[model samples]
Target: MEDTMALQNDLTPVVEMKGITKHFPGVTANNQVTLKLYPGEVLALLGENGAGKSSLMNVLVGLYRQDEGEILVRGTPAEIHSPKDAVQLGLGMVHQNFKLVETMTVAENVVLGLKHLDFIPSFSEICRRINTISRQYNLQVDPRAYIWQLGVGEQQRVEILKLIYRGADILILDEPTAVLTPQESGELSRIIAQMIDEGKSAIFITHKMEEIKRFSQRVQVLRKGETAAVLETSKTTPSELARLMVGREVLFRLEKKICCPGEPVLEVKNLCASNEAGRPSLQDLSFIIRAGEILGIAGVAGNGQRKLTEVITGLDRADSGKVVIQGKDMTNRTPLDLIQSGVSHIPPDRISMGIVGDMSVASNLVMKEYRSEPVVKRGIFNYKEVAKSAKEKIDAYNISTPSQNTEAKFLSGGNIQKIILAREIGACRGLLIASYPSRGLDVGAMEAVRLQLIDQRNIGNAVLLVSEDLEELITVADRIAVIYEGRIMGEVPAEKADIKIIGHMMAGASLKGAAQAAAEAELGEDGI
Candidate 1:
């Protein structure tokens, strides 16, 4: 561990906020918060959703003004009233969502918002400037490529380069690697490290504990709009950080007992489906998920996983083939019909497909069964019964919300997932199709979700988990099936799965070719 005194040396904090408080109507977003950022050191702002991590940062970058507080930059009080003022004071913020024009080239997007662009600039000159900054920081952005053509990692490089080009000494990043692949994340860490080596400072806001331990020099936890604790990175553990952030000790592991499979519950034969643009997205797909077993579909994003889930759940129509559940044909049944026929679907897009965002949480809880049972008695709505069930499920799922009557859109991403899972997993069903169930959840919440899926499988309910994360698929699924270009490339047992073959399949290689390539690559690595 590096000595804290050595890391600090004689440098004072480049930015400081004392007793910051921000308020909204009927809510206090931040209350008497304090923060300090030193040059050449990375600070991780850790918290659960709505913990005011962003609110504090926003006050610094001029997005939000503190109702009561003092900001000091370099031992002097600084007043920043706008983004331009913050930039002028050598502070820059990269938002959670990148602000770039997709139709423009990288160079154009970089120079778009500068006030000095009163004169028409030469494209070649701008490209030269971008290339110089890119090489200096190891950001590796193509100055001539269109923004839409670049990958997520490359796009992030452009965002960082823009700040550096504008002569920013302090950088703020929000959820920087949320959409990055594991390899991309490694490269991003290297880039951030290089930036620190060049004497630039950063404050990274994220919910990931691993990123804090691996990337940041110190950790500051926030809980319910207040500063909870700040600790040296090498001296603290993730469990302790999570405990402080959520106000409770979090369970990090799940309990999984091996169980044997049973009769087939869902069988798809020669399934064919088309995307919204009338192109084939699922072709000749066949698989069977049995009782007490989980079948995981592993593939890169946008490789027919959505189509498969939609076809099975009756959200999208199949062009050909049949879907059989317990020897019953369900080729083109409606979504409601499938739900009533013992199928529960956790859709990919929770906000759009899973729940009604404007509706109350209690109403969304009983969406599936509103037409029947205690929720609706003799065509009359029963608010008391719905409230009772919603309260029970909310407590069971550990969802953090104001109340059952609160709007679903006001909850955090993790709580929204819990609401959907609570409604799906707790229902009476036989087949559960979970698409990206743990996509945006924190590590502790992810454990709870995986446990729920396993519990369903243990109780003889078949589960099909479609996910882009290969590690998650390996952890939960009994059998892994690789898909590519609307076709099943190969099937492998999860116990003996090889990532090289899966990566090859996702790149559109045939089954035999992928296996051969994987074997040859392995042998080459061993110097055979």
Candidate 2:
């Protein structure tokens, strides 16, 4: 590491931003921020959501112009007025949500926007070049595969290949591993290492602390739209980075009491469902969540987690299944029916499904109960009661909003999530299904959300937590269920769960199969 740092110190920065400042309505997104990326090194950008990391990067990528700053590429001032200019200057960004045409093949997508392409470009030449880059970086994806036919990790590799194909040497990866499985993330780390070995520099924007430690040479922490601290990754710890990012010490572990599970609250028996593509998603999946117990569903995204949640919450229909809530069969019911049956859902897409962005915070708070008494009386809404309820929830949840009347869309991601938590938890009677509840939140806000889930469990609510984060599930859930291809691969008590076994189950291996495979591998290692 010391030798690598010494070599990097001797090289000019591939990209540099000086005194970069950007502003939006009523807020300064970046307050004279500065960033530098040396050649052949990975710089991990760490920050809470809305802490100006994206805003600063957007300036460099030509998505937004800086109000007061200058950007230098290879020690020369560069004018980047659009993405085309950024690409021409050897800058490419792989955004979190990929911008690929789903119906197009990988080779076609790679050369889609190049101005130098001939009227009838040779796809054979394009595929050959893609194959070369793929072999060089060990990015294994078929060039002829369509975007929709590939897995999430393959799609991500295609995105990177697009950048590399465009002659980009400086890469910006925004939460690259957010949708990947554990094994895929490891593969991505190796790919990035190979890129750096070949003298390519990258700026990795992510919230996960372990990734920062494993993937980058130096770490930059941003707080309140300014540089808080920049430290060598080897010399600093995750706790120190958390403190720098939030301006205070953070508690990584929570105090969760032993669960005293009661009667069954939710039961899904022989459940079957199909995805939007008309393919079978949930295949005879069955589970039982008891009151006072939090049952966590752990799997890679795009597994039956989404479909299962939708079926149970009445957002989607089950082809064949039995959904029993507190001994009452409620299969194929409407969302309102499930709500009336004491089911509360914290949807994954908070902006679209959880809350109406155009509505005021107060109105959104009372959305579920607006048709009931106290909020609605004699066919009229009581504005004072709505405001009173919103005030209590805002204070209780620590939601940082301007006022109750402010539109929900104006708030930050964390605050918007808090609003959903407050509303759902307040209305929860018997069951609460939360999907990736702490996702994209800062350490401080993530801790708050986890503690709230524990609180719900302690208060005798049946909580079905579906998360891609294994550590979070192990933390708060009394028991964890591994889902794969819409079936329950296995269920184990969280206290006794083995991460290796869980990972295998998430990849489609049954519990007994995984155990046997582990035993055989151990025996082989011992030369038995």
Q: Which candidate has the top score in lDDT? A: 2
lDDT of 2 by residue, 418-517 (tens): 8898899888999999998886677888998899889988889999999988889998898999999889999999988878788888888999997777
Q: Write the per-residue lDDT of candidate 1 for residues 1-528, one digit (tens) a residue.
A: 222446574678898888999986556778998888888889998887667776788899888899999999877899988777888888988876577889999998888767644675688988898888878767788999999887667888888888887788899988787656566778888878887898989999877788998889888888888988878899999899988887777776555678598998899999998876798899999999999999999887667888888888898899999999877898889988888889998987676578889998888887777878888999998989999999998888777677888888766666787889989887748999998888657666777789889889999999999887887788788899988888888888887887888888878887679899999998999995
Clashes of 2: 0
Clashing pairs in 1: none
Give candidate 1 regions above 4 Å deviation.
1-6, 23-31, 80-90, 96-169, 183-187, 190-198, 235-252, 274-279, 351-355, 498-528
Model 2: lowest-lDDT 10 consecutive positions: 1-10
